[model samples]
Target: ENGEFKPAYNDTIKDYNTILEMFDRILNPDPMSYTSPELKSVFSKFKDLFEKHYEEQKELENSYQVQSNTSTQAIKAKLS
Candidate 1:
């Protein structure tokens, strides 16, 4: 087994929430009031980054699940 610890689904949720909270704080006092083009651009970039990381996290979780299932199946096959 690898000595590294992969992030779990809960961990990703916490991370995503933290990101949102940070952005909320940044735009606090009137988040909807930010209508400037530059602020919109920044917001768009943040959204893109969030989406990219979410996709990557989803893939990692899926791969981890597949690996776990395969290992279980292999063990069962051997015991058969």
Candidate 2:
């Protein structure tokens, strides 16, 4: 957003924390002009973090489905 400065924060909570934590250093960056190699490397890790979230979401969905099926089967057996 900052003329290709590429702030990793934007609108994401994950990225927000990334930027917020380093706000002091970035807000008054040196005029050499500016760059933090460490920040870039850490931001690149977003992909893996999101991937882990996706896997957990899938696991939660599958477990709910299994519980629903079990409950349905139990009800049907009572009617039989």
Candidate 3:
């Protein structure tokens, strides 16, 4: 729980849940029947951006994990 924000580890799940909610809203036509075309377009854009952000964050997390594991193994080797 450092001050640094880790999107991959911390925000990914929350963001994904939010995305799921967005998807549900988009797919359920009953509630959105009255929504304007402009608003729907905006929602579509938002969903795309969220997906891109999620992918970037996940990649960053994977890179960090790989680096961390490599460092740990090096430390262990040095100690041995």
Candidate 4:
């Protein structure tokens, strides 16, 4: 299975977690489960990509939240 990712059987976005949780699962899958070097390598590579994406998404969300909260606070102050 060179360059092929194993599909998560019957899984959907509804099962997904926030960015940090995703990163945690990637870097910490059950070590006893993988018996081949190739598979392990692939897992590592995939995890790296996932972790990067997670970090980027988390940053974006945080930034958006900060802006939204600031705007809300400003609006509240003006209203009062």
TM-score of each: 0.57, 0.48, 0.69, 0.54
Q: Candidate 3 — which pairs collide?
A: none
Q: Report lDDT (Cα) of residue 35, candidate 2.
A: 48
Q: Report model 2's TM-score to 2 decimal places.
A: 0.48
The per-candidate count of clashes, in order, stands at 0, 0, 0, 0
* Predicted candidate 3 versus true structure: per-residue lDDT over 1-80, tens digit per residue: 77977543345455577766756566454653666678778787777887899899999999999999999999999999
In candidate 2, list every pair of residues with a backbone clash.
none
- Between prediction 1 and prediction 3, the one with superior TM-score is 3
Candidates in order have lDDT scores of 0.73, 0.66, 0.75, 0.70
Which segments of model 3 are wrong by more than 4 Å?
1-15
Task: Identify the superior model by lDDT, candidate 1 or candidate 3.
Answer: 3
Query: How accurate locally is residue 16 in candidate 1, as Cα lDDT from 0 to 100?
Result: 66
> How many angstroms is residue 72 displaced in model 2 relative to the true structure, after the best TM-score fit?
0.5
Residue lDDT tens for model 2, 1-80: 55678754565555444644565355345566464767655554654575578779989999999999999999999999
> Could you arrange the candidates by lDDT from highest to lowest?
3, 1, 4, 2
Report the Cα lDDT for residue 3, model 2.
68
* Residue range 1-80, candidate 1, lDDT tens digits: 38977633335446666767656654452655545667766876887788798999999999999999999999999999
Model 1: lowest-lDDT 10 consecutive positions:
6-15
